[model samples]
Target: MAPFLKEFFPDVYKKQSEIKDSSNQYCKFNSATLTMFTSSLYLAALLASCVASYITKAWGRKISMLTGGITFCVGALLNGAALSVWMLIVGVDL
Candidate 1:
């Protein structure tokens, strides 16, 4: 399996362990439902990301990057300080 996968997609195979670690951590944080909900939100965010990319195209890369960084920091703080699982979900959306 290793030989077959590496022959086809070495970079993807190399990242398998990290993917597993992320999956394990995701499961530990919440139940399966929450994980699925979060994944759906992530997909939604990816679609939103395309809009963001277009909106920021004329705004300058540095400014857009900083805005995204700040938004992520705010989200992390809310998630870390959440009082309930629902709040955590809302925070993750931020």
Candidate 2:
């Protein structure tokens, strides 16, 4: 969390690192952004899962799995190459 914050939101990282509170370390900056960032991935997974069986049935299990793997790889690549926080968030939500 610290490293990610320092990489993207440097100012937030600097201010957060100055805090004496250890228990609330990861969330001292912005709860809303943190919530959205963390929750979006789970929400995306939930949405995908809701349609996974239908997709598998339509495309067959092998093709469905392959497509999912490719999509995961692409999202990972996007995240690895992300230039901004929004890009990172989008990659995560993919």
Candidate 3:
């Protein structure tokens, strides 16, 4: 969590120093950026699941799987290369 916050969210990373005197790490890092960082992945997964059946039916199984795999790979790569918070939200994959 600290390293993640440090990379894309330096502003929030500054707040981590407050944890040095206590064990309430969870409470210390519940910033809005953290919420979006974690929740975006779940939201993306939900939307993908909702559309997956339709995509699978519209295309053949092989095409559907290939498309899904390509999309997942691209999303993962984008997430891995992200340098900003908004980029993370846009490309977050599970």
- Model 3 agreement with the true structure over 22-61: per-residue lDDT tens digits: 6554666658887878888899889888788888888868
User: Top TM-score: which candidate number?
Assistant: 2
Between prediction 1 and prediction 2, the one with superior TM-score is 2
Candidate 2: tens digits of C-alpha lDDT, residues 1-94:
8888878878777877688777865556764666677788898798779777889999899988998898888889999999887787888766
The lDDT for every candidate, in the order shown, is 0.63, 0.80, 0.79
Which has the higher TM-score value, candidate number 2 or candidate number 3?
Answer: 2
* Rank list by TM-score: 2, 3, 1
Estimate TM-scores for all models. 0.54, 0.78, 0.76
Q: Model 1, range 37-88, lDDT digits (tens) per residue?
A: 4585787488669867875888977887888788788878986786555556
The residue ranges of model 1 lying beyond 4 angstroms of the native Cα positions read 1-32
User: 1 or 2, which is superior by lDDT?
Assistant: 2
List where candidate 3 sits over 4 angstroms from the true fold. Answer: 20-26
